[model samples]
Target chain A: MRLADLGERSGVPLATVKYYLREGLLPPGRRVNATQAEYDESHLRRLRLVRAMIQVGRIPVATVREVLAHVDDDSLGLTVRLGAALWALPHPAGEAPGAPAEAAGPSREAADDPHRAAADLLVDELLARLGWSAARELGALSPAHRALVATLATLHRLGYPLDADDLLPYARTMEQAAAHDLDRMEQLPTPREQTEYAVASAALFEPVLLNLRRLAQCEESNRRYGL
Target chain B: MRLADLGERSGVPLATVKYYLREGLLPPGRRVNATQAEYDESHLRRLRLVRAMIQVGRIPVATVREVLAHVDDDSLGLTVRLGAALWALPHPAGEAPGAPAEAAGPSREAADDPHRAAADLLVDELLARLGWSAARELGALSPAHRALVATLATLHRLGYPLDADDLLPYARTMEQAAAHDLDRMEQLPTPREQTEYAVASAALFEPVLLNLRRLAQCEESNRRYGL
Candidate 1:
């Protein structure tokens, strides 16, 4: 396959495929001659993954580069590699006062703040209730832990009350979803395939989970209000 | 309370409060005399909601206005009002080629497309598995349904295989989360409180659901790979 066929087969435009090649998102095909190079099945496969991340996941190219690099490094353990990809993917956090959404999450400098302490504690309690020691073992050190706490603190500041118990149901369900995800990914043939699956699934299926919740809420509202 | 006092109580800056007033996000305080007006608890409450949507939800001002109007219309039934709010909130959908994330959802112009048909039938199967006729009854017309279908379609186009059974567990759990949300809102005293709570909770707690999944994925990955 040539670059043109790679693009056509993958349903990506030729120019965009060229752009990915230039950005090193897709490695150059084997040099066939002065003005032409031949792509193989591997190039097509890589191009497909890159397109999924950029197009469906809306991931920035630099982050995609980091994710691809993490997946490429086989010296790391499976969990570590997968964790790197998850970390590289976007997760929302609380915003600073009047700050833009991009600059979210409360500062660590506010460790003495009661609101921060309370929110952080809520995450621990929720994790405990779900019996998730992997999350609890890391305590406030985990990025996801910090991010959840910051989001809770922001909710508190806005006069919306939240408790660990309130999140228990959602937490349990999210854990269930994660189990389903990992179980499915385990059947994949290779580490790279599993990591790619994890990264893409996290980014893409998030919307499925989110919109399903919304759609269900709609049904619930209709039931309650006689719509 | 006066304008300054209103801003103080809401934790919204005085400048931002004034800007909200100018932007029609907040109605003007009762006129006390020239250059003076009195604000009450209601004004304080509205300001809080406005700040939550802007700072936490990252919702645009125009969409907030639409949502607020939906809530404010006393003539509309409870479900209608709530549905309007849900519609106004952001939901991820499939992106068009070369399109930005903002312009998502497959265009209706392609009604005959097989990918669209398969993705949509997948949603119907998912709804049937959950016994959610409310979602099924609405069909292709519902934004959330369409959004989910479009999302699944995008996944298929990217070479990701998904089945209705794969989403059944997730949909069941998301329905549970919605039950939790609506039950909590049912306890609020007034329609205004309930509506405001629904809007705020939907925007703010979305992060909790999202990050919790990431954290749970971390735990699951660790369990499988032996972190």
Candidate 2:
């Protein structure tokens, strides 16, 4: 299809599509002549994925690129690719990616960052208590791990005083739901397909998880406070 | 306590505390004399909440003001206060707060936003099917409602084809979790305490929900694909 048709069909503006191509977010279309290019169905699908990641997921372009790299890396196992996809999402505030590992650097300034050490220890204890094997693949400093630690710190900072044990039930609940997510993805025939599903789920479905929790909170509140 | 002591105890910098005061996110300290003000324990607590909301919750200054206002409003019921807190959190892209109701504006241009109308209808159908009374208090145009609709719409746009029926299990699981949250909060002594807990829970603990889900997903992947 022509670039115009690709934009029309994908519902993305031609200029934005061109910009994505320039940014390496979209694969280059086949050069048709000196002035034009042709996009295929795969391009349309990729464009849609890009839009989903950027527009709906609110992911930065750099993070989106990293996630796409993981999706494209055939050497990685399904679970490993899924792990990378998980880490590639936006980090919570006060937590940069690999924050704990960064604190291990030799710079004099690194030693002053106690929050990273505290968070790492907290998560280690929680994982040990939960008897979960995920830490083996996630590494101690993966963004997801740091995010959990940062959350606890925030709660404590607000005087909420959440114990690591308090997170167990919620973890178990998510594990049950995630089992369903993986069960469906595992049925796909190819690693590429599995990675695609993993990426899409990680990027696009976060709002589903969050909004569902909010809605449920509302229901619980209504029952408690209402006559 | 003095303002300096409040800043020290809260761990928020004096400059930032002053900024919150100027922004009306924190109440002014009682005047002690010329060129000085006396802040008490309440100021210290409010400063902590402000830091949590801004740093951990990533809430913008304006929304923080609105949320704090709701917390301080004695005339509002607990349910209303919670609903407002829910609305004040970051919303998913394509889901502006009160989006469903925006289409009802008198301007002829308003009715063309089909995504909003479609999302509203989808949520309405889902709420009816779930037999949840939350919609009454949440209002059809509430932020949580818009977020849910926007998520479903994003899925559709990305070619995932999620029906409102498919959201049932997620809603049920979240209800189970939220019951725990509300059960804990209801034990607090007064309406003010309840509202504070609700706001803090809504604003700060989102990372707990998101990161737990991510960690659990990793475990699910390990179980399915690991040796």
- For residue A170, model 2's alpha carbon misses the true position, in angstroms, by 1.7
Writing each residue's lDDT as its tens digit, candidate 1 over A1-227 gives 88788989888889999899899888788898999999997787788788888877778899899888887778889999998878877666855555323224434544766666677677777888888988888755566777788888777777775987788888888889999999999888899889988887887787888889889899888777877
Candidate 1: TM-score of chain A is: 0.89
Best candidate per DockQ, number? 1
Top candidate by TM-score: 1
Q: Which stretches of candidate 2 lie over 4 Å from their true place?
A: A28-40, A94-118, A187-189, B28-39, B94-117, B136-138
Query: For residues B1-227, what per-residue lDDT tens digits would candidate 2 score against the true structure?
Result: 88888888876778988888998988888898998998887777777777877776667899888888888888888888777766666765432232233322322332565544555566777788888876644554566665666666556655666666556767777878898788778788877677777777777676777777778788777877882
Restricting to chain A, the TM-score for each candidate equals: 0.89, 0.81
Interface RMSD in angstroms for candidate 1: 1.6
Candidate 1: regions farther than 4 A off: A30-38, A96-107, B32-35, B96-108
Clash pairs, candidate 2, are none
State residue A50's C-alpha deviation in candidate 1, in Å: 1.3
Error of 2 at A152 (Å): 2.2
